[model samples]
Target: MTDSTAERRHELSSFLRARRERTSPSDVGLPGTPRRRTPGLRREELANLAGISTTWYTFLEQGRDVRPSLQVLTAIADALRLGEPERAHLIMIAADETHPGEDSEYLAPEVADVPKMVNPNPAYVTGSSYDLLAWNDAAVELFPGAIDAAKPNLARWIFTNPAARDALPDWPVVAQGLLARLRTNAGKHPGSPRFQRLERELRTSSPEAEAWWPRYDIATSQAGAKRVRSRSGQEQLMTYASFHVSDQPEQILTIYRPA
Candidate 1:
């Protein structure tokens, strides 16, 4: 009923609508509706599938005084075909019933489900915000002393850690790309604690990082063609590919192929 609450509800409504539209009828085992007025499920059909009343669903979507229950939120989330983050957003909104008039931040962690990277090619998959979630065997072997899953961070390794200076044959190329990409993440997630921690650690540990952290930018490591020097002193250049499992949007799968 408050302006901020109304605004957040409106935003949530728009998000739900957009996500619903993005899903096709076949995706949810629904028959295609040639005569359907909208591109996806109608509000009534969705409410029916969610087992909630049409009026309640409509009130929720309309940014009214509708306090959604966990069950109801789950139902709506499923009906809307929301991803985990989206589902989390719905849960947060529904669970905060006591504070009806207050707005909420619903951004789910971008790194919540990043895939476990493994294998012979040196590669890593980070969040859309560039938090290093996982890396492969080759990446570990090449970088040696870099990935401490206990402390796995690409930016920290490239900048703060000294091994990178020796591990990288072309430090500037690797370093620049990394810094630039991290700069980009910073811009998108300025208030992110994980990002702040990484930035703080880098600043305290590396001089180059301190200099670059302030120039926030928005870049992510996706598909990049690059090479590395193998332990045998041979240059092993390779192209890397990143995969985002459709079923697991939060997890990013990065695979490396030796070229």
Candidate 2:
């Protein structure tokens, strides 16, 4: 007997979540009830809209024993009002496909254009995984050796680079959070060239990093206070707000404000 495996079921689950939360009943043509217990559409409602059975929708959301056809996936995508990037992400996740080559060149200029003039507060843009791709003068000045686009990557610097150790005062606390995020990304993109490159780079560069890498077990980063030591001897603790750039699939906008 052969064991059937689930593929892209996680992606389908993710797509379902992102879809339902994005639309309220009023946003679509569905009736809104103040007494409704669920925050978003019920499984029955989603099935009704997608022209499928509630049991089938439950299986899809449960990520159980399902290999949805492209036509069916397209129907779900359309029903969810998914934009191009969101649609593509749903498709890729469902297929369990990897796009490392496309993923590598993140932080396109259009996604987060550098200001003609630098601001007082330090800021930068990275990929979805917080891989620092670009920063302005203020960001560069704030962390003397922080943004080196040529070999700049947040994960590598956080785990391997010593200069980064100095720039970020609370390394011990932040490293755990950062590595957990990398762990999740790695699972999604196993054997990817860039991911492998970063993994190897960290392993070779820091044995401490290698020891801790395998134990990481989380996907998202928490909005915690980040502190950095300034050259003048005081610490610059700040609030970091992370935003996803809608048009560019892999870009993020991060702004730092003084604490």
| Candidate 1: worst-modelled 10 consecutive residues by lDDT | 98-107
TM-score of each: 0.49, 0.59
Over 4 Å off, model 1: 1-118, 128-131, 245-251
Q: Give the residue spans of candidate 2 off by over 4 A.
A: 1-95, 114-118, 128-130
User: Best-fitting candidate, measured by TM-score?
Assistant: 2
- Model 1 clash pairs are 183-217, 184-217, 184-218, 184-219, 227-237
Best by lDDT: 2
lDDT of model number 1: 0.61
- Report the lDDT tens digits of candidate 2 across residue range 1-259: 1111232464456458646765778766888887877677787877777788889888988878767778887887777776665566556566644434344654556655652233666677766455777677777766666566576777777776677778778887777777756755654554455666777888788877777665433445335478987767678788877666677744666667688
Error of 1 at 143 (Å): 2.4
